[model samples]
Target: MTKPRPPLSKELQLRVFRRDKWVCRWCNRPVIFAPVMRLIESKVRNAGRVEPLSYYHTHWTRDGAPLLDELGAVIDHIEAHSTGGSSEEPNLATACCRCNVRKSAASMHEWAKRPQRKPIKGKYGEPQHWDGLSALFVVLAKRDRSGLTASEKDWLRVLAGATADAR
Candidate 1:
């Protein structure tokens, strides 16, 4: 019998998110934290603020409908694993919940060829702000890793230097 594939390590998952800047490779939409809804729910419980902050509250549409929260980044195999793709970084990308679910097990080429929905626009045709908690989520989700690949370590060092320079 074929051995069951091991689950991806948490570190690897975070790395993929960082590498992709928490944007879906397919749709380029920012993936927001799913847990923020829980945070809002907790506030509702403690502060008793009921009207605006419902348990089902999420990013709202122009039409006043609630857009479902994306929760967190999902690692998608650019080449489906069922088609012999390995779990290495090269084969993986960060995907928003919607795109990932829609893509399913389709090959990347097939997915790319499909028609894409137009991105939502704001008043005056400005792009809607989709990165609600991206910076905060990135900071909270990443962990320092001792066993990072050489490139990963180098990228972190560069980021550290940039941060230091800003101060």
Candidate 2:
């Protein structure tokens, strides 16, 4: 037979949820299906009565976004307690279904280092120009890689050519 776990105390859950402000700690935003419960006694202005706390694990999306439900939303810890992170309010956050899964087991600092934050060019964002010896090496390595696809090779060639012309 499966073991059943004891329910958490209402006061304790409320304390943790309130400290998190119903947002995911890592992303600092509400995820879609993060587990949230309605506090029958509490209400928010315009947002309605009740608040979200946590949700079922199944609701975590493949890309780490939270799924939304009629009841409310879910909150997640950026760094799970199992990984030596705290269970305090500062450790919790509200995330959409996706962000939570993506942030799994990662501290905010580690998650922020993910390459997902790539720079864009033009109006989308500013391009980060390569600088220093390491940057030059990346340019050269990209150019010299015979295994690179045509598009990648073309981009590397362009970068190398531009740098060479500048020098």
Candidate 3:
């Protein structure tokens, strides 16, 4: 029997997201840090003055969330873990929810058989500035640090260093 895999550490997941610039490996789409979306939802819902619409839940609904339904960030194994791939950073990739769900456990060759995401044929092509709204997440996280989970706190530190290096 295949043993159930343990949850990937938030630290490792963040590292992969950073490495991939939060773009989905399969679709080349910018992915959102879902937890940040949840925070935004809570803040918006609590503002009593702003209630005409609702932010969709991260893992639910066809209606797009604040960033879009397909944009939730996830870590994918480059080689299938079930097929004996290691869980190391090099073997992991950042993917959006839509592509990850579609690629579920398929071998690369099999996944290649799936319809490919079309490239932007525009003169400019894909925009290069996407950081998956990670900057926004960092800002909001600092504003609401009282509720941060240990993992989130670690993210703040990592991101702080990143932010520092960028300047």
Candidate 4:
């Protein structure tokens, strides 16, 4: 059997997201950090309780949080990982949940089979500042400190530093 794949460090994932400006490389759509969507959905003003689509990777067609399921950000392999691509930053790209699942480990040949994605034309042009809703995530995460996982605490420290640098 092939050796089990090691997880990519969260820091590396963030780097790709940053480099791509929180836009999906494939479709040029703005992407939101998935966990941030979850937090928003859990609020009383939204769904009052975490909906199944919010956390269970059930983002296909839930009505309550439309974008939550479809535009959630994820790191994707630019080169098909199933075909020997390494998880190095150079081989990674930021993709939305829709594109990520659709592009799953597709080789260049399979990719060619899919329709080419043209950059979307919007009246406002490309977004000037998009952090994948990461700043909002930090704010919510700060308010829910006790709920943070170990890695989230690490992210808080890292992103908190980035946020301070921006001001």
Candidate 5:
């Protein structure tokens, strides 16, 4: 059975968010800080209720611009507590609501290898690039592979490409 994760204090959440520069570590997307006062005013103006905000993932236009929406932020455990991971700062990172939900209880390396839908290019037919995922793969490929699983090793091999130094 998995142990219950320890509760994280608001102070600790703030610290981790700041440490990660208010950005989702996995997708490298900026966290949207919704202004509480503005929300309150909107609610008042809308008869004590406002249109529900989009707390889900963000969407980008074909031109590579964000859709001017808010993305909920979360602090994720890089290594899952179910797998004996800790709640220490080193194991914490800021993530968007989308990435956090998708990565629940999964290790970073495992989650990285999962296939993702390719984004569409702009009208001019510019190539769509996943710079964030590419950077993450490069970093993971360069890490020590002594304790990696077979699947992880295979992923590293593919990520590292033929030109990478022999392990």
Candidate 6:
């Protein structure tokens, strides 16, 4: 026989809401439902799998409409809770539904580390921004991974953390 589910307390509900800023913990989309207690329960139930059923409520439009007029994409937990993961911004990522299902039960770090082709050469002779934001997007778009030099990579990493207002 299955064990009875525990009731979610008001305090616990508030904690989850506050922790997520009353938004969908994965996509950062605001949830329309009040209390959001029910949504939390659904996510917990489907927690272990890569594709949780609860995602529809969080990632989808408030009226249950599809994102981008389709299922949109998948939301992934960079670190699984089973291995002492925290539900924080750094640990969440967006993936396509197909990719998420394909990576089920696999370690996220291992899955993300797979080798791929490098990005193509840029039309601009040099990275325009010198700031990290522009470089980071270039890093994300390029396939050749070989393009950016080590020093450039280091600079981009440092710049990403720099304040926009900083000179």
Whole-structure CA lDDT of model 6:
0.39
lDDT of 4 by residue, 1-167 (tens): 43566888878888899999999988899998776665665554343544254342344454645675578788888887778988999999999877887888788688868975665667977886999889987898788777666766777776777565322
Q: Model 2: per-residue lDDT, tens digit, 62-95?
A: 3222234321334456566546665556765544
Candidate 4 residue pairs in backbone clash: none
Candidate 1 residues lying further than 4 Å off, grouped into runs, are: 1-5, 50-72, 119-167
Tens-digit lDDT track for model 6 on 11-110? 3433343344333433333333211222333445645655434323434443443332122333445565445555455555444333444444456676
- lDDT of model 3, residue 156: 75
Stretches of candidate 4 off by over 4 Å are: 1-4, 45-65, 116-119, 162-167
Measured with C-alpha atoms, the lDDT of residue 156 in candidate 2 is 46
Order of the predicted models by TM-score, top scorer first: 3, 4, 1, 5, 2, 6
Which scores greater on TM-score, model 1 or model 3? 3
Ordered by lDDT, highest first, the candidates read: 4, 3, 1, 5, 2, 6
**Which digits, one per residue and each the tens of the lDDT, describe model 5 over residues 90-116?**
988887656776888887688879863
lDDT of 3 at 36: 72
Task: List TM-scores for all candidates, in order.
Answer: 0.57, 0.36, 0.78, 0.78, 0.51, 0.27
User: Model 6, residue 156: what's the lDDT?
Assistant: 36
Better of 1 and 6 by lDDT: 1
**Strongest candidate by lDDT:** 4
RMSD vs true structure, all candidates: 8.9, 23.3, 3.7, 4.1, 17.8, 18.8
Candidate 5 residue spans exceeding 4 A from truth: 34-38, 41-70, 116-167
Q: What C-alpha lDDT do the candidate models reach, one value each?
A: 0.58, 0.41, 0.74, 0.75, 0.56, 0.39
Q: Pick the winner on TM-score between candidates 4 and 5.
A: 4
Quality of model 5 by C-alpha lDDT: 0.56
Question: How many pairs in model 1 have backbone atoms within 3 A of each other, for residues 3 or more apart or on separate chains, i.e. clashes?
Answer: 1
